[model samples]
Target: MRRPAHLTQGRYAPPVPRRTLDVTSADGSRLYAEVHGPEGAPTVVLSHGWTCSTAFWAPVVRDLADTHQVVLYDQRGHGRSPAVPPAGHSTRALADDLVAVLEQTLAPGERAVIGGHSMGGMTIMAAAERPELRARAAAALLCSTGSADLASEARVFPLPTPGGRRQAHRRLLGSRAPLGPVSPPAKWALRYATLGAGASAEQIEACARIVHACPPGVRFRWGHVLYELQLTRSVSRLEVPTAVLVGTADRLTPVVHARRLASVLPQCVGLTELPGLGHMTPIEDPDAVAGRLRDLVRDHLATAPAPRGERPARQKKEKTA
Candidate 1:
């Protein structure tokens, strides 16, 4: 798919990383990771959604990199990350990969406000109970994701009956069909399924470029996992302050999923609903997504108690005086 001219440059293009590395997951999958912003600044790690690479976070990264240490990683089988064995496609692998990134990137006793979109959000939920997550993550932002009922609640398929819709979506998800070049028709279809009605040509093209870049086999592998996703228990186990964001027009995982997440999350902060946006919340409204992340950083990470064995800046100044 030919991207629009604007998308070829500016915020649509992937941000330049200060450092890049490969993080090896517990299952031996190597995840591609990029670090941005000043060293030792408050950190924020972002996990992109299914069929999306770290590039999908360009806008948000641009907004935050000046002040925060922003870390972006490609999920297994997505972006620069190599495809993993079929056994590594489960939610447990997602958790393992997240922990690996946290352990490798963050300084000892440091914590970050983590943000995930779609499948990335599922990654956070899957890792909620992990000691690594608890130690390194102070807060979380879950965007346009569902804990369960993905296929049954998806607005695609247009079938009148729930069972019919679920069955149709399951088949569609499992299909290994190639997504050919991004033509006008393909853009329209993508917009209908993922973005809001007012999505601009640039936004559609940006989404298309990232989504189409995903390998068909990898897409199908993750799609099958999503088809059978059941992570409500995981969501409940998230003990840190967490906020949920979703679009009212979201077709894949609708507003209901956000409401459910808000209700079930152990430390539910709040749910922000954006009218007219679809499943691609971050791309559809980058400002809103960035704003929420900033809020989490300010409220949770910034004011968090300094890690053990580390002295707060103010305390050190007082001692010197």
Candidate 2:
């Protein structure tokens, strides 16, 4: 599960400038991240899913920087964080690291409003285990992600063949090399296979580049891990105000999973069902995702007054059509 040398650093940095912070993980691995927005505002820590880095949040981050302090990081084995021994990577361990990052990065008594896209969402939900950190945050947004029983390999992408998961996992562990450099043909195949018919060529090309560039080893190992996870039990434990958003057309982590999670979360206040969208809702429609996040922030602010000594903060008003 250690990151192979090639994909350890992101092939592309986010196209925006933000403050970079380095945190030394418990085992001495260096985890790096970028912060956006006014330093005094409540921090919104955005965690990317498996096989993704902070760069994946670029679109959503771009829209919210003005109103909320945002922190985005590559999870261990994904972006700038040095890969761990594959055995060291687990949902709980990642969740523990999240608490550390939140404690170190934010001012005393300030809790982050956490959001995660896929496995990223799983990590946040799992963070509920840390009572101190969980109590500091205002709300949580689980987007295009779900809990354990709600999640399945079939729900993520088309089910890999029997043992497909194992092969991908082995390849990622560096036991074998990837099929080859992601090529134009492979890109097209992915779009057709995952996007369903009529998916745009431009979208396909862009996604292909990102996938192609990812560390083949990281991609394979994480893919297997995702297949084996059951995050529903974790979702049931999140006590903070929570919201769920899902694309109607998501082939991976489909809306059904979102629906199931919304039913179990005691604090879930909103469920957004975006029609005609797929798994990449946050990236595919930044404005739509931002609007929902803005609403969640506002609701959390309204219901619970800010903690004493916390900085004065406000959510941006979404523009009326």
Candidate 3:
């Protein structure tokens, strides 16, 4: 169902899924997944970043679900997905969760265009060599992410010295401090660190709600993953045709990260840097992100017919449990 309220420019209301399911990851983590749009349509599977959930993808889903089947899932401890044990918060876990979602949601042997933002993009890089990713990803969209130097490259705190900046950003990345509430100060902080100066209040509120809802422990653990992330070698393993996008004013993962990603990806298709945008590229500018996905579908998925969500004889719908 369309949300008329979020339909207005720069507004973000969570999209209602046509169907929902639980996907079990390799380590027995259960992820909440949703499917939207019509049957027999081009499919896109979107993964949100750290401290964000399926709701983080709402605007892009709303934009594309009118014509493309959109798949979204909560990261292990976000949204309806339950929190994991101590060792369950690594990038490997992120990859495992993505593989499970793709396997469960798509019909057997069916593939879709995959997109990731921030930590989600790192998840794609982490899963680069997975058989599931190699098999199921037709193309990829890596948005507002950095494969390496996340802590050192971030400009959120902006300390004077590079050494001091690294230490400061490292602390910021791995901090376990709770975000008490989505107050005005909190919104301002979140907006300043994540969004560009031009971001509207509605966009800030939408993102704050999702990011603040993340469990502190979950956020802490994933924050550590990002802090220690090193995936330059893995970028080449993402052999599929891939496009990258970033915002010019992105403080978390800057345009330099996007440039590095574009240079290393084996089949890098294109990289578009949006001016005056931030780390929340899809939310701050959904149309641009959705347009890139459409381009991927047109380029790579044009020959593959969309699979009906059914089997041959009994005509039963595909099982996504």
Candidate 4:
């Protein structure tokens, strides 16, 4: 794992100590990823949502490391990756970055089971639209994300009215108060506001620290894109089998959105709706998410016929040469 040099001297640092793997972006920008578990096992790539880094997936990573290879990266413009000059920050660009990581770290010709939480899921869906990535994927886990036109599905802070959304975006973009590396107070606010809403005091405090330690610029700029973003169109073209996992209580990406995605996806197999889980399904219920992911992976692997040895069902009676 490699660490980007910019992160060390930047305004924010990750609250928890994280291992780093150096990777390059589609445009050759240096990117860093935190990798866990054995390298030879089946690979599972974990992607985090907006305003978050790889640390958000720590719980799930811990649970899956023993059985699978887990790779987590801070998306470009977040975590340890250097924020480029607005040149490589679009949804498609982020999708390309994900491919770069897979090509560089994972073995050649290997297909991986990819899971993205929230915006992370959207990134993977966008990646799936790419022919190169779609061909290399064993399966896809779309967790807590939805497709095109999300005005009704997600909550846009400050509202998307005529001036409200733009005002909010300007505030977030220009205000060093929010993006100039979070202060402890700001971190606490974020914890209560997002990550640890109903969690224990200890958990809330821990989350606050993590939130506070995030880079301000990353949070500010990325939050704007996520709030105003939608990915439904790109995902409709995805070629691999997909598993849609949604928490029943998710207010951000509601169950209706998940249902729609499942209905439209060509390869949707497991559409598991967990009771009482919320937007941050992995963080809110790591075990449950892990269980469903494991089951989905196993089911796909088990049901899929072997390519070289097994005959197609229609041609089963034919003799082998």
> Could you give me the TM-score of model 1 versus the true structure?
0.92
lDDT of 1 by residue, 123-151 (tens): 99999999889888888999999999898
Question: Clash number for every model?
Answer: 1, 8, 0, 8
RMSD of 1: 4.9
What are the per-residue Cα lDDT tens digits for candidate 4 across 1-321? 432322332112222322567898778887788666654555678788876677667677667666566778888877667887765666877788888888876766666678888788888877766766765677788898876545434443437573564564445434445433435666455543344245444444444444555666666666556655677666777767788988776656678879988987878876888776667777767787777667655654333322432233311111111
Please give the lDDT score at residue 212 for candidate 3.
84
* Model 3 lDDT tens row, 1-321: 422222234448776799999999998889999999876677899999999988888889888887778999988988889999979988889889999999999887777899999988998999999988988888999999999888778899887776887899888877889887778999999999999999998899888878888888888888888888989898988999999999999999999999999999999999999999999999999999999999998787763334454322212222121
Candidate that beats the other on TM-score, 2 or 4, i.e. the better one: 2
| Full-model lDDT for every candidate | 0.87, 0.67, 0.86, 0.65
What is the alpha-carbon lDDT for the whole of candidate 2?
0.67
Candidate 2: where are CA atoms >4 Å away? 1-13, 149-182, 193-202, 302-321
Instruction: Tell me the spans in candidate 1 whose CA falls farther than 4 Å from its real position.
Output: 1-7, 303-321
RMSD values, in order shown: 4.9, 6.7, 5.1, 7.8
Query: What would you estimate as the lDDT of candidate 1?
Result: 0.87
Superior candidate under TM-score, 1 versus 3:
1
Alpha carbon lDDT at 58, candidate 3: 85
